[model samples]
Target: MAIRDQSYQRYDGPVRTGRSWPVIGWSEFRAYWRFWRTKLTIFAVWLLPLMYALLVLVEAALMEPGQLGADGPGHSHLNLFVSTQLFALALVYIARGCGIVSDDLRHGTLQLYFSKPIDRIDYMAGKFYTLVLLGVVSVFAPAVLLAGLRTAFFVQSDMLAEIVVLHLQTLVLLAIAIALLAAVVLGLSSLTRRTGWAVLGWIAILIVPLIVHAVGAVAADISPWDRLLSLHGLVGLAGDALMGGADAMPEWMPRIVPFAAIGALIGAGFAALNWRLSHLEKIT
Candidate 1:
């Protein structure tokens, strides 16, 4: 019996160093886009903005010069689209974020990740970046493009300044919405190793609030503060405040409540994520 000597040989390669988070984020981002379903969903969602823009153009073409006032059909349509699209954005968040961390845990990939030069924060940040980018592409980018297109082709000269201001406000609101939703989904993902459980948790978090809010609305003894119980309602209120539509919120419900609720949700999510990851790190 002859045994051949086989020894490990060290090969020279680039030593990975600081700020590998972007590389991690980029890899995930590219991987997601490779899936046909993801590509299709993104295309469909982005088409919405174009459809709204076309509606604005059609309305502008058909209406008389002075008839299309500041509060015209185009304006109303844009506002409605922005408000109604939150649910779609939520779906995007769930689809992309629910499995990100849980998959790592389920497949025992966390050990491999931690064995590398990456810190837990960097790993979390990488996942967070991917989610945030997906949210922006699915929701924020489209809305901004729609606003710009409307301004370029449909807005009246006198309304340009006002429309631009509204667009900026919408951008801010969309950014906040994406950030908070991403945090919630990532936190949920960290809490479970099964992607299905994480998804179910996200659904419950979103839907249960709506159900409670609906029941409160129908009850005769409902308190004004009960409105805050609805996460969806709070998001709407926050959007209203951002767009200078504070009159839409209840007189008793202060404008700050919605912003505060969003802040609290984000904070709680981060805390949960930290706790879960820290425990996992200790175990490893």
Candidate 2:
């Protein structure tokens, strides 16, 4: 029989009953931060954003006010900066998110989590919060800050409000994009216990669709709308449209198609997460 430690006393501490997810989120966030890969990816990704900052400074100082307007390339720079971070985003997702759920399951940590007052929803919320926070810091912050910097240095007072509104709209769009990606990453992470396989699964999810779309476009001469299967393509089209850049979609395809594709992807991700949760309930 296992010996019991009689020296341990029952807790008389205050039973605080507030949201527990933030604690779980911060804990997971710290764990990810300790990884060398996470640190390196963050350091490397910030360099491009710094260059974009310098470009913004020069353009704001020298370019004509009209060039920074609604139809200007400045907005594209903002979108482009975020797009360039997608590689870094993927790296970070692999570093931290790929194992977020699987590691817990593999090591039997969920039992510990469930032993506490935290429900499955709170635990899932923490996981979502961690990935979303990563996305915001790594992708959303740079893009939005550049937008703000442009608005501050370049815009005339009369057009200030309009620019703010446009940039805010773009920011919200980017945020939605971040959340969608987070959901997909977490959902995929739950499917396997091995981090390596999770990473491969994530890669396949992003790449296989494009390969299929490419084959169809070439062999069947499919319409441009078929790109809805390509995650990268859908995001690119959505970003350009959200940035109010020139429309990237075909005239035949509705503007809503990319957004709808994003919604569908998010729904699929949630389905995966719920399926995993159901599995956990069955076993535990």
Candidate 3:
């Protein structure tokens, strides 16, 4: 009886096998790279970041030693580096993210992806890696090259440690900023398939908070902590951190505020992305 039951269970119904995890991983990785290549072909991803990197090199080459001040505004390669990194982050986010989801939908590819065996989490994980990879390559890569050149050319033993620490700090901050920006832009783009509408959405997502802060900075005189819940607020906080590290801003708070805001923004953006993916399933 036991032998008969075992055989019966084996033949009870047809079994469906899912795609192997390794294959899925590879496929998703390849898909991400494909998207990246397509995006990179555009000028902003390739040309703009390169130009920005060269700009950093130029400015660093121009910097004279012992000119940076402890309390006053002056030229510093470190300041230029941070500022350039921030600008690069903004450039990549606005350029790449504007079309990440919109183009897929506009091209009618998103529906096919929805029909795949992959879950929303897996898809999102892939998207997250893709965005993070681009950020690393575009922002951190240039910063590293410039820092190396500067350290080799000018920095002393004492300044070397500071330069290393500053590079690490900038890397962490840039990663979080770019990742959060990607998620928000991708989520909004997914919600609406039109590229024009997506670009409009991106602007609205970024601009509204600045308008609020401008009001608050003028009237309320409160900590801009409330602003972090929005895009501009979060970037503004990160800017403070970058500027603080470069001695461009007054010293009062820890650099942790920007890190914390990045964490929260990324968390919220992922949650929203998950919601969008779930909705995609319903429609498909």
Of 2 and 3, the candidate ranking higher by TM-score = 2
Q: Say which candidate scores most in TM-score.
A: 1
Clashes of each: 0, 0, 0
Choose the strongest candidate by lDDT. Answer: 2
Error of 2 at 56 (Å): 1.0
Q: List per-prediction Cα lDDT, in the order shown.
A: 0.75, 0.76, 0.60
List, residue by residue over 1-284, the lDDT tens digit for candidate 1.
33466666698888867877787777888888788777777777777777877887897788787765546323334445665666777777666668878888788887887788888778878888888888888888888877787677545567777777777777787788788888888888888889999999989988998777678778766665665665566666787666756586777777888999999988887777778778876445
lDDT of 2 by residue, 1-284 (tens): 33474466789999979878888888998888888888787777777877888987886677675566545334565455555766567767876688888888788888788899987778888988988888887877887777788678745656777678767866777787787788888888888878788899988977797788878877997876655766666776787667664455576677777888898888887788778888886535
Give the Å error, residue 134, model 2: 1.0
Select the stronger candidate by lDDT from 1 and 3. Answer: 1
**Per-model TM values vs. the true structure:** 0.86, 0.85, 0.65
Model 3, 158-224: lDDT tens per residue? 4566556665655565555667776676577667667678778777766676687778788978574
Q: Cα lDDT for residue 11, model 2? A: 92
